[model samples]
Target: MNWKNIEGLDGVESPGLLVDSDKIQQNIDRMIEIVGGAEHVDRLFPHVKTHKMPEVTRMQVDAGITKFKAATLSEAQMAAGAGASEVLIAHQLVGPKLDRLATLIEDFPNTKFAVLTDDPQAADAINEKCGDADSPLDVYIDIDCGMHRTGIPLGARSDALRAHIDSLSGLNFAGLHVYDGHLHDPDLQQRTDKVKEILGKVALHEKEHPSPRIIVGGSPTFGIWAAETSWHLSPGTTLLWDFGYGDAHPDLPMTIAAALISRVISKPGEGKICIDLGHKSIAAEMPLEKRFQFPDLPDAQPIGQSEEHLVLQTANAASLHVGDIVIAIPRHICPTVALHSHATVVSGGRVTGDRWQVTARDR
Candidate 1:
């Protein structure tokens, strides 16, 4: 889309962020279509941690999605209050976080809130909380299946954990959470094999436990899990059209829907130009120090970036004099998006003048 020449955008802005709302909706639709056809699954409870925008979350809810997996307590409460019927705190809710969880549960009594934990102490804590409130708190046991980030190793100990949760009164073992973020490699065949192997183990454990009502599959493994089980696949980033997550599959439909639109601030050296956006604007987690791309100026490439300046490699650097607008696609979309407060909505070459707030800016 030629964003610069947009109708409502002509006199309003320069050096701003832009989001293709159509593209985002399309991405969400495509993901739903992919997971919707699962053999006998109830529904895909998409993870809302990716795009923390309440508007985007409502878009999912309006599409008949009632369940969601949140990475944080705030995400769960925010999403549930907005419209989510069931919100899963996909991470272990421990320490002082439990107090907030208790309060949110009190606030949203109709909403289903669940948390994941491998430790029995958390189960005891949940029991205490429930005892205090005189109600039950839904819970899930995190099973470590290859990915060593969280969860207890799936085996004898896992079986014991399930039994322990079953014996508890205030805590209910909702299901299992297996996330294989490592499987998001470029090699499609290898990734598929890994997913199959990991899921196979989870299926076995589920059979033995036969207690959890919801089996939460991690993000990258959503497609496989949707195919294998009748549970929800927590696919979050699938909504935001991130370049970094889908880097493995070059043919994936989700493209970089958001870009950091900046302007040439200076012509510092030979064959180089500095842009207004820098690490402050783009994601610092990007693999490279810089990334430059422009359909209009395809030859230009990113070389490096400073705190406030981005240096691009281009032969026709002189063509992009001071104040020339340049749009940069960040390697990662999540953090990059949080860097901006509003996005300049555009269509084709005309600006739509729609501004979207970065709702997930808080740490």
Candidate 2:
């Protein structure tokens, strides 16, 4: 279970998260390269919900990506504090959260902060909270482009919401925000057709209303949206890819940049060995087999999983012993990264004695 040439592996503990800095830079470079180059970095507004760290955000900033989209106030704060020119809290804010969003704007006077709003009442709440601020808060009308999530319907409702924001004293209607997360098809042509169908509606609406800008697409439909260069793209998982998206879209240029390092702790049965990774270590949203995969032991089958232990039954069970270190690639890396407090940084094939704090976790 030993990794041949990874320096400083002996010092790392079991069930630790390791992030390769080189791969991260490569992913960022690939995204920018796909979108023409550094000149087109502004077209990308990557979501911060994936990595949720100031260090990672700083890397994007250094790569000429100035705008970011976040799901929480903490993530927005981190992005702004990390020197991003603009930050969009993509989630709707209501009640007291509106005040927190306003405070974030007040705290960072130079950075532009915006939020997504689907409900008219939520728009009113945001205006009321930021009424006395120096400037009106930028707002985007979230459009329900077949996701049926938290967005105003794409017809009259969307128009009415946009008009309502325009009339508000403390809010400025920026544009439309569309997330096509449900369009994750393994077939490239199928995904392309779905994007054409959904984005067609957005184009029609733009013809009537003439929006200043439109932010569209998530990780799955980034390449689809990229073809329509007029719109802004917001792809997050491209930075730290997981097995789920990578396997589905092998044509993508990015590689897996994050992994879970665990150790075999016990051998309780004849052909079974228990590892330290469980639901608490990796993401459990998918089935056990799809949640993570073992590269060293590809024939291993996950037999049992609990809060802190994972039991595997494999023909090579006898080859592993207690304290044997293994690497696991998470199927979904976003939530798997949220479960940990910090990540061990690796660079030049060695652990760099640096730990990145998961800043926006549980915020």
Clash count of each predicted structure: 2, 0
What's the lDDT for residue 202 in model 1? 72
For model 1, how does the per-residue alpha-carbon lDDT over 304-347 read when each residue is reduced to its tens digit? 77788778878889777897777666666767767777777665
List the RMSD of every prediction in angstroms. 2.7, 1.5
Give candidate 2 misplaced runs (Cα > 4 Å). Answer: 1-4, 132-134
Q: Candidate 1: what lDDT?
A: 0.71
The segments of candidate 1 whose C-alpha lies over 4 angstroms from its true place after superposition are 1-15, 37-42, 130-134, 214-219, 289-293, 347-349
Best by lDDT, which number?
2
Predicted structure 1, TM vs. truth: 0.89
lDDT of 2 by residue, 1-363 (tens): 123257987789878898998999999999898777888888989999999989999999999999999999889998999998999899998878887877887899889998999988988888888754457788999888888877877888988888899889888888989988888899999999999988788888778888988999998889878976568899999998988999999868788888889989999899899999989999998888888988888888999899999999988889999988878989999999899999999888889999999988867
